[model samples]
Target: MFVLDANNPEALAECLKELNWLAADENIVTLTIPGAGNMNCVLRVDTGKRRFIIKQSRAYVEKYPQVAAPEERVVTEAAFYDKVREIPFLQGYMPRKIGVDVSNKLLAIEDLGPANDCTVLYNEGEQLSEETFTKLLEYLSGLHQQFMKNKVDDELENEEMRKLNHEHIFKYPFMVENGFDLDTIQEGLQSLALPFKNNSLLRQKVEVLGGLYLSKGKYLLHGDFYPGSWLQTEKGIKVIDPEFCFYGSREFDLAVFIAHLYLSGQKEDLIALVADKYEGFEQLNRSILNGFVGTEIMRRLIGLAQLPLEMNLERKKTLLDFASKLILNEKI
Candidate 1:
C-alpha cells in the first residue's frame, strides 16, 4: 500500500531502503520526471553517485487520474524485462530491469539519462528516421518471433489493463456521447469525427477487431508500441514501457506502429517499408492488420487518448476517411 511520491524524498528513501534498492545511508540528490508519461508514476532518481528510474502504477492512470487502471502494471513490465533478458538484441534496445517490489507495485530500472522519447515526432516538422524505424521494427520482430508461448495461458494476460485499453481503442472513440469533446482537441475535429462514429458498417467492423485484440494468441505483443514507447538514445532506438503487453496478435503491435507513421505524416515509402522489412510480413493476415491500423488511427483522433499532433482539421478529416477505408477493407 506504499504510494510513490517524488515530492516526499524521505518516504521514497525509506521505501527504497526497505526494498534493498537503496542503501541506508544513500542520499537522494534529486528526483525529477524523466519525460512525458501517461500510464504510470515514473521518476528519475539521482543519488549523486548514480542514477536510475523508479516507476509505479497506481489504481488510476498517472496522466488521467479519474481513469482507473491495473495497479500491478509495472510488475508486468518488470516481467517483460525478465522475459527478454536472454535475447541479446532486445536487451540492447531496452532499459535493464534492476529490481522489483511486487507488493508495493514499484520497479527500479537502469536510467537511460537525457534520452528523450520519440514523441517529438508528433510535433511539427519532426520525422521518424528510417534508421530508428528499422531498429524499432527489428526489436518488435524479434520479440514476436522469439519468447513466444505455444498455447495462450494465463501468464502476463494483463486482462485488466487490456480491458482498460479496449475501451479507449475500440469502444469509446466511436461512441456518439462518450463525454469527451473532440472539438476541444481541434476546432472541427468533433464534427469530422461524427461521421465515423455514426457509420454502422464501420462500427461493426471495428467491433470485430476489438474482439481479436482481446483474444489471446501465440505471440507476445508490446501492447502500446507507438512512438511514445520508443526512445532515441545514443545507443539507438531503445524501447520502453511495455506495461500493456500481452499474449496477442503480432499484427496489433505492427498495426499500431504503422498507424503512428501515418499520424505523424511520414511519407508513403517509409510506411511501405514495414511490409518489406518485417519478418513474415507476407504471412500475416493483412486484413486483420489493416483493421487494427485503421482503428488505431481513428481512436487516436476521436478517442480520449489524444496525441500532440501538429496537424490541421483538413488533414485529420482526410486521415479519418482513410481510416474508414482501412477498417472496411476498401483500401490497404
Candidate 2:
C-alpha cells in the first residue's frame, strides 16, 4: 500500500531505508524521473554515496492512470531480473537489479546514467545501426535460447499482466467504438484506420494472433521489446522495462522489434538482417512469426498504444495496407 510520491522525498527515503536499500550513512540528495515512465513510477534516486533507479507498480499505469494494471507487476519483473542472473551477457544489456520489495511492489536497479531510449529512432531519417542492433539482437537470441523450456512451467506466468497487454495490443485497437479518437493522435488517422478496423477478416486474423500471444510458450520474452524498451546508453544499447515480460512466443518479441523498425522507416536490408541474425530463425514458424509482425504493425498504427512516429498519412496508409496483407498470410 506504499505509493511512491515524488514530492515526499522523506517518505521515499524512509521506505528505502526500511528495505535496507538506502544505507544508514547515505543521504538522499534528489529523486528525478529519468525517462518516459509509461508503466510504473520510476525515479533515479541519488544518495550521497551512490545512485540507482527505483520503480514502483501501482494498481494503475503511471502514464495513463485510468488504465488498470496489476500492482504486483514489478515483483514479476524482479523475478525476470533474477531469472536472467545466470546470463552475464543479458545482465550486461540490462540494469543490475539492486533489490525488490515484494510487499510494497518496489524495485531498485542500477541507473544507466543520462540515457535516452531508442524512441528517437522514430525521428525522421533515423536508422538503427547494424553495430547497435548486433548487440540488441544478440541479447534477444540469448534470452530465448538460454531460458527456453522443453515443457512450459508455471513460473512467471504473469497472467494478469499478459491479459492487460492483450487488451491494448489486440482488442482495444480494432474496436468500433473504444471512445478514443484516432484523429486526435494524427490528422486523417481515424479515416485511414477505418477500413482496417472495420474489416472483419483482418480483425479475425488479429484476433487469432492475439490468442496465440496469450497462449503459453517455451521461450522467455522481454514482453515489450519495442524500440522504447531498448535504451541507448554510454555503455551500449541497454534494454529496460521488462515489466510486461512473460514466458511466451519469441516471435512476439521479435515481431514488436521489427514492427518498430518498419514504423520508423528503417531500410529493408536491416529488417532482413534481423531475421537472419537471430539464432533458430530457420526453425521458427514463419506463419506465426509474420502473423505476430503484422499484428504489431497494425496495432501500433491503429491501436491505443501509439508511438511518436514521424509519419505522413500516406505512409501510415501504406504501412496499414501492408500490415493487413501480412496478417492475411499474403505474399510480401
Candidate 3:
C-alpha cells in the first residue's frame, strides 16, 4: 500500500509509479494544494504528461483535529462518481474517477484544469450571471428528477456522512455553549448565539425541520450543495465534494443553493427567478424548504463552518433577522 504526502516529492514520485500514473523512466511530478476544504487532503498531481487530483480523508478533520470524521466517506464519494457515470444528464459535470486505493482510503480523479470555485465570485464581489444560475438549477433539477423514486444503492446510502452533516446543520449552531468561539471568527458574534440558544420557539421550529431532514429520503442528494462545491471553468460549471452525498430530500439541496445565493447579495428578483426555474419533485413542501434555507443561513453566519463573506456587522444582523423569519414559517 502506498501513501501519498503533498509535502514529500519523493513519496509522491513513488506513489505515481505504484499507481502506474508515471512511467518507470518518467519520475518528475509536481504537487499543489487547490482549495480550502476542511474534511479531506486534496492535492493536484501534475505529471508532465497529465494532471489529476488525489484526495484522502483523515480520521479527524484536517482543519480542526478534535472533530472526528469517517475515513470510509471516501468510499461513498467514489460510489457517487460511479453512480453519476451511468446517469445521462450527470455524466460530464463530475470528475472522471481514475482509481481508488481502499486500504489507503484515497481516490484519484480527473482534474478540471484552472477552474475557480464559485465562492471566489462572492469573495471578490463579482456578480453571478443569470445564465450560470439557470444552468446550475437546471442540472440540480435534472439530477433530482432522474433519481426520484429510483432504487438507492445500498453502498451509496452513506448513513454515516448524513448523520455527521445533520449535526453540523441542525444541532451544533444552536448549542447554548459549545467550545466553538464565534467571536474569534468576528468580534461580537458570540452575542448572536444567546438568542438562538434561549429562544424555545425557535429551537422547536429548528428541531421540527431537523426531524424532517432525518426522515425524508425521497431522492438522491448532493448533501453539501453550497457555492464552495461549485466550480466554474471554460468548459462549464462542475460540482465537487459529494462525500456528504446521501438519500435525502431534494428540497434540502435546493434550499442550500438558494441560501448561499441570498448570502452572496444576489438580487431578490434573480433569486426568485432561479427558484421558479427549478421543477423539483412533485408537491415539494415550501415551508420545509424555507426552514432548511433559514437554518443554513444562520449556521454559516454564526456557526463553526463559516464562509468568507464580505459583509458588515449591520448586514449580518439583518440577515439573521431574515433567517429567523424563514425558520418560523413566516414569509421573508
Candidate 4:
C-alpha cells in the first residue's frame, strides 16, 4: 500500500524551491498520494500561511522540435478554469488557480482540505443512500442549468477539443492497448438473454449519439463529473477535477452522473427519478432531459467512461441484459 508521506517537510520545501514558490520560510508539508492521475503530479503544499495544490504535467522532450509543440494540457485547463470562474455554483466547486509555471507545465490552486479525502462517490458505492442521491441531483441540476444558459459561438474551438479529448481518449486503439478486449465484452454480452449481435453495434450507437449531440452545440461540461469528482462538505457538494473540462454537449456530463448513479445501484427507477427532478427545474423540459439521458447512456456504455454496472461476471451479464432491454424498450 502506498501511504502518502505528509511528514516529508524537507521534500516539500525542496519541491517549493524547485517550483520557485515565492513564500517566506515556514513549515511546508507534502500531501499528495499515489493514484490514477492521467498525466500530472497532483501535490498539496501547505505553508503556515496558505495552502494550495500544485498540478504539474511531467515534461516530454520533443524528439523532432518541428514536428509537434509540446502539449500543455495544464495551460488548457487553466484557461478553462477562467472561463467558468463567473459561475457562482462552480466558484466553490473548482479550486482557484493561484500560480502557474508554464515552463514545467505546472499550476497552483487552492487546496480544499486534508489535502485529499476518500469521500468520492464511486468509493461510497451502493452505500450512497437517499441523502446522497438528493445532494448529487442538486449538484447535477445546477451545473446543467448553468451550461444550458451559457451562450458561446466558438464551435470550431470545441471541435478541435473533441479531436484532442474524445477521439484520442475513446479511440479503439487505446481500448485494446488498455487490456480491454472487445471480443470478451461481446462474449459477455452474448451470455446474457438480450445479447448484442456484434460489437459494431456499440460503435454505431456512439456515432449516432455523437452526431445528434454535435448539432446541439457546446455547453460548459465538467468532463469528468462522476461521483468521484464531487465532494460533500458542511457547505454543500463541491465538484472538482476540471482537468478533463471541455465545451461540448451538456449531456456528456449528465451521462457520467447517470453512470455513477447506476454504479451506485440506483438503476431500478432512474428514468422516473431523473425526469421528475429535472423537469421540475426551470427552463428545462422532460424531452430535453430524456434526450440527454439517452445520449449520455449510449456515450458512457461505449465511450471513455466505460463503467460496468457490476464487477462480477454473472452479475455483469444480468445487468447488461437489463440495460439492453431498457435501451431498446424504454422511451428514454
**Candidate 3: where is the Cα deviation over 4 Å?**
21-25, 150-155
- Cα lDDT tens digits for candidate 2, 151-209: 98887899999999999989998998889899999988888888888999988988999
- The best candidate by lDDT is 1
The TM-score ranking, best first, is 2, 1, 3, 4
TM-score of 1: 0.98
> What tens digits encode model 1's per-residue C-alpha lDDT throughout 1-332?
98888898778988898888898889788999999889998999999899999998899999999998989899999999999898887888889999999999999999987788888898887888788888888998999999678877888899999999999999999999989888788888888889899999999999999999999888989999998899878776789999999999999999999999999988899988998789889989989999999999999999999999999888888999899999999944
Better of 1 and 2 by lDDT: 1
Each candidate: RMSD: 1.0, 0.9, 2.0, 6.4
Expressed as tens digits, the lDDT of each residue in 63-176 for candidate 4 is 222222224666767766676577766565667777666665767777666423223433425455555566566666666567653565662243433444444323432232
lDDT of 2 at 96: 85
Clashes of each: 0, 0, 0, 0
Worst 10 residues of 2 by lDDT: 22-31
Which should have the higher TM-score, number 2 or number 3? 2
What TM-score does structure 3 among the candidates reach? 0.93
| C-alpha lDDT values of all predictions | 0.91, 0.89, 0.82, 0.52
Q: What TM-scores do the predictions have?
A: 0.98, 0.98, 0.93, 0.69
